[model samples]
Target: MPLLLAFLFVSATVWVTRQAAAARTLTFLMTISTVVTLGLIAFFLFAEAIPVFERMGVRILLPLEGEMWDPNTNTFSLVPMIWGTAITTIVAILVAGPLGVAGALFISEIAPEQVREIVKPGVEILAGIPSIVYGFIGFTIINPYVSSELSTGFGALLPIGVVIGFMALPTVVSVAEDAISTVPESMKSGALAMGATDWQTMKSVTVPAAFSGISAAVLLGLGRAIGETMAATVMIAHVKELPQPAYDVFDSGETLTTLIAGNFGPAVGTEYLLSALFAAGVVLFLIVTAISITSQYIEERMKRKLGGEV
Candidate 1:
């Protein structure tokens, strides 16, 4: 809709230019309006929750930071849920990061042109798959296998990490591939001309040149992994406990998204439960916002560096 409005405004400006000489002024006004609209939408997400947090008071943090997450008792300790999110996020990134980078390198640097053309579309299809489909696949295939064969009662983290890793793979691969593809041909040629192997050339020259893009890809994957609700909520059982039962990957644990999702429907009132839910949302919002801002900074730096405008 914004695009359509922008298009119509531009078209109207072009028509008005035939009658008046102030078309440039109209164009600038249109541009500023579009930016304001976008900024309003972005700002609303942060401002909407302030009232909820303000009413709850600092007493809310006691429960949020304490050992347990008993909303009925007016306790709102976020330690357990925070730990679950942090651990799973770390695990998913650890699994997805290197694999995504390698896949990007393969697609851009090593794959034959024809092979790349054929495979790249298929790679993108993975990202287009729905979160519910991933959840179904994890529940039917991975979860049961872990419970029946791997051990007695592990139900969450490892499977979710692996599945989220798969879901994140395409985003990372596509972004990193674009980064690698942008490396100057002269750089690659020079490395090869110096008798460096293809692998060495990619490792030393192409990878470093595209490091910012790869970093953006990893951060994007992190956001995707952290914010993922349906797949993680479905595949992992929701428990309020902090410590992992057995240091086992299969153990059930709750993430902030999972907790928000599973409890929001049943949670209500000015009670601890409702306050805790908002607190969880606050944590998720902060983490995702921080990551997004960092990613933008890296992307801008990369653009300036690559364009030699820095």
Candidate 2:
């Protein structure tokens, strides 16, 4: 039976490989598989979360005034977690944006060929380092320094934001570098021939021309920051309350990703608590999906503006 099954599998593989129509059909099937998988995931999340919505209504899930998330006591306001996610993402962008753009500009426009080759690879290598390693570094190195020098706390947003920013920097730098490098050499030459300095040409011409790509890169980085989980779960203080004054980066806070990661285990037997976690997952999925769609749209627009077809 095994021999016969193996022979049948080999025959099918060989037949598919030999036929163009078969190959195309397989590709279409794979694409549909991805869409189907995503649909099922969304459906599962919504289905699991529906119980909570039915039991408590939408107000409990999205309360405007209350700031607690105690499932044992029955409170389930997600505002604090939502705010934490937002503030951390914004802080990461603010830290990573200028540094990433400057690094891209330096590598693409200013560095000598040898220097550019070395620096670009080095920057790209940072992306391959595991997120857990970054989390460990933040917890061990950054947290202590901040505790001694600034505030004595576990969940200051600055250090976590900076670490997450570094994690996201490679994406921004790589995309922006590719975008800047794609600017036609003729444009730079024209500017130089007209007596424009290199800096002037880069600042006034190359950057403006690549703004759409840069914007897409930033959005992609923001998505990365928002969706990061293990690193944040380890480094953040994981407080359940809203930050005092609502703008305090130094206060301990908890993000949706971390909240879900840290609490889902205990919530398994509790129906409403598990559903609430699933609901948070749905929220995160929507946020990341929106950012990805926006990034793709910007990239498509940039390509069209550059005379490329869709």
Candidate 3:
């Protein structure tokens, strides 16, 4: 089997990598293999999506008011889902970014060794919780609470976004904490030596120093939120229309992930619906890839800023 050959090849390559020359060669091969694998996936995804575009024209990518995503009726507009994904992800990032950064700062700069020992691990443990559990919490508690108290739809945007934000929080906290920890003590010491208060030094030196990594952490959180399936599925209704008023976070909606996830059983052999779903997948891929590439650029710039290079 191809998998067995790949496994044996990898094993033999790893053995050969015990020598320095073959190690570099094998590393290059591995990197190329990964890149090629990703390329193939992207190619196939786009290829599968082409049928929808050809059948429906580019109207599939346009915003709503006309057609909503009922594939049984052959309507395949993607904008409402895009809007849902964007709104929820924006809410999630807005919630997670500041909180995660603050958590990171507290853990890296303010917490004593014993406190860091406890809190940091506790935060990381949150990352291990199954996302489905978060979904259940949202569906059971937050959704009903919002529906009762706020008098909104049970599957409102704000509550679902908040749940996703909290789900992403531990990742942001962990990565941002590492970024803060990477800040040289010398920089903080210099600020202190200049008669800066600890708070002032942290505000001026540590945060700025760690800003890019923090930024990347936030982007990663956004990516997680955008790609989230189980939580979004459980917490939100599968409505395909744009939210009434468009600005109301209390509106029920479908997200890109939930769209793909929710329709699979029904979409099994239906060409247009399947293709539209794949097209959604393609869009999701592009958006996430753009975020990842931007994060990488920011990280590189951060490295240059920290390294005393022009």
Q: Top model by TM-score, which number? A: 3
Tens digits of per-residue lDDT for model 1, 17-127: 674545666677679988898677556644554544565565444444454666556555666677778878888898889999999999898889999998899989989
lDDT value for candidate 1? 0.80
Instruction: Please report, in order, the local distance difference test score of every candidate based on alpha carbons.
Output: 0.80, 0.85, 0.90
Error of 1 at 192 (Å): 0.7
RMSD of each: 4.1, 3.4, 1.8
Per residue, candidate 2 scores C-alpha lDDT tens digits across 1-310 of: 9966775686578666777765676577669868999999999988998877776677654645554776776668677888889888988998778888999999999999999989999999998999999999999989889878886577677778888988999989998898888888999999999999999999888997888878887887898899888788889998878888689887778899999999989998898899888888888989888888888888778768766565
Candidate 3, number of clashes: 0
**Comparing 1 and 3 on TM-score, the stronger one:** 3
Off by over 4 Å in 1: 1-67, 152-154, 245-248, 268-272, 299-310
Give the per-residue lDDT of model 3 (tens digit) for 207-285: 9898888998998888989999998999998888889988788999889999999998888988999999999999999
In model 2, what is the error at residue 45, expressed in angstroms? Answer: 1.2
Candidate 2 colliding pairs = none
Clashes of each: 8, 0, 0
TM-score of 2: 0.89
